[model samples]
Target: MSVNLYRFGKTVVTIILKPLFRIQTIGTESFPKDGGVLICANHIDNLDPPVVGLTSPRVIHFMAKEELFHVPILKQILPTINVFPVKRGMSDKGALKKGLKLLKEGEVLGLFPEGTRSKTGELGKGLAGAGFFALRTNAAVVPCAIIGPYKPFQKLRVVYGKPIDFSQYREQKISPEEATEVIMDEIRKLISAHK
Candidate 1:
């Protein structure tokens, strides 16, 4: 690949994604400036990851779908941008291992608890993967919400909630329902503030 492609991607991201989408980040003070953390958020649009990443001052490693990797052009620079692929639905142990390793290595793991984009324009039920990762790694879980349609020439905001401790899940061995409720409550609050 020529150096031109890399230059072109950076230019497009800066010129297009940046200028077109006016992003506002609030409560970023809640994010741990340094350390391994499981950053989970609601999934409304595919743009959520990049919007959150750009807003977050901390270096974040994103867990994107494996299908996006099919792009020959993107394959060149995605790595430099800190994006990774995860096989949706199935265990995808490879992705799990990678996610855990990133946390263990003291890196931020960007995840979408809903697992996929919401089809009905309402917050969908979140999956247990985020909980499983948080429990396994003992990383702080920061609930975030990407609030808006995020179309070109439109302004959007991403709200980050404080990191929640999950030690109880490991010690008390509470039911999954309890853990799910704990998470949804935080996510709900983040969404409500945007409206």
Candidate 2:
């Protein structure tokens, strides 16, 4: 049902992107087959979500900006593809609860710790949300990187790094802010590797 629609959307996106961006993915084998998983990446542009969703082996439920959900068509279609809205800047308790519930059900949750796109392509300071969820759920956090010029007719790369365990950090009483730094550092390395 929903899964079929997701795959259909991915197929459509892949077909559309193939002739435009030369999409290349590396280290996909590191993505977990099943479990409560979190895919944390650096945000560069609006295309980051769909690009990651289309390339990922698993169906990715993205935390989209709340504004996108208000668009007429997307308002009706987003839920079918598992995209939920999250208000930016201030905390959105409902979105956080939804994310936790999804992870508890062993779903793949995609998030960008930077919260907003980086216009310069340089990785920015991460928000604590990703680490907070990782610590709370003890989910495997897979660091992802999106590289290359973010435009049509250019080579774009999606790189995945090994899953990071936040359980130890949680046990050691490390703050979510500290854990975010660690996760973002790994994401930085992945992006650097491909450059």
Candidate 3:
């Protein structure tokens, strides 16, 4: 990964966004300092990734839709900024394996559990992919919620909740769908708390 590029991009984004939007981050102290962590947040706007990444305490490697990589400029820039593509809808084994490897290597992976943006800016149903990674790696799952509209000069908040440990469910016969509910519930609470 291009660490320098990621840092540069973050610096630029921060400079541009700080004035346009009143951004606030809460409960960032809950983020794990070491080891793998999965950051599952509710998707609202297309800019959610960068907005969340900038407010986050850690450098987040995000899983973006595969279509984004199809653009020539984005394909080159996305990777430099620590963004990777994943096929949506079906089970993309390649993407899943890549995410698993990153987690095993103690890297943080950011995913939008809804798999797509919510038009109404409300939290949508969580996808099974996030739960699969959480249960498979037994990494800390940190639930995050991005609140407020994307309008200029509007109040925007990114709330990070306490890390959730799914180790106990590893022993039980828990499906990814069930595990997803556990993660989503935490995110829902964070959103409600800020509203």
Candidate 4:
């Protein structure tokens, strides 16, 4: 039921955004057709989630800040569209469990590793949480980038980087910080490439 509503919402959003923003996408073929996958991207504006989610073919189960869920109407609508809340600035064990469960079920999980949006719209250092989940679940990480202006009628681009597999790194007992640096590097490249 949620999946159906997600699709419907995506279609509706696409229709609205396409004409207004001139949104374009590339490298979608990099997405894994099956198995658990992580979509990690840079967060610039609040519009990033809906833009990326609507543009991608996969139904992205996005981890959003708990505050957004408190909005009067959005609290009821967001869950139906695959948006779930996570407490910020601390480890939320319940959110982690929910994320792992979703990945174990071979679903796609979308996250912004920067932990928060960049006020200047520039890339920021990524938190280790994304790498932690990637290592724990052995999920493929797809680095994503969103570029260009956020205003209406401006061209916006979404680029998906090739999946980075950390299984070898996990086996070698690499530090979470090191692994996160690698993931963030790929995301940085994607953002730079698209710009």
Which candidate has the top score in TM-score? Answer: 3
List TM-scores for all candidates, in order.
0.85, 0.96, 0.97, 0.96
Error of 3 at 168 (Å): 1.8
Q: Clashes per prediction?
A: 0, 0, 0, 0
Answer with 2 or 3, whichever has the higher TM-score.
3
Tens digit of per-residue lDDT, candidate 3, span 1-195: 899889889899998886687888899887899899999999999888999889888888999999999998999899888888899889999899999998998999999999999988878899999899988996799999999788899888989999987878788959999999999999999998898
Higher lDDT: candidate 3 or 4?
Answer: 3
Return the lDDT, model 1, position 93.
90
**Location of the lowest summed lDDT over 10 successive residues in candidate 4:** 1-10
Q: For each candidate, what is the lDDT? A: 0.77, 0.89, 0.90, 0.87
RMSD of each: 3.5, 1.2, 0.9, 1.2
Worst 10 residues of 2 by lDDT: 165-174
Model 4 residue 152 CA deviation in Å = 2.0
lDDT of 2 at 109: 96
What is the per-residue lDDT of model 4 for residues 76-101, given as tens digits with 9 covering 90 to 100?
A: 99889888899998999999999998
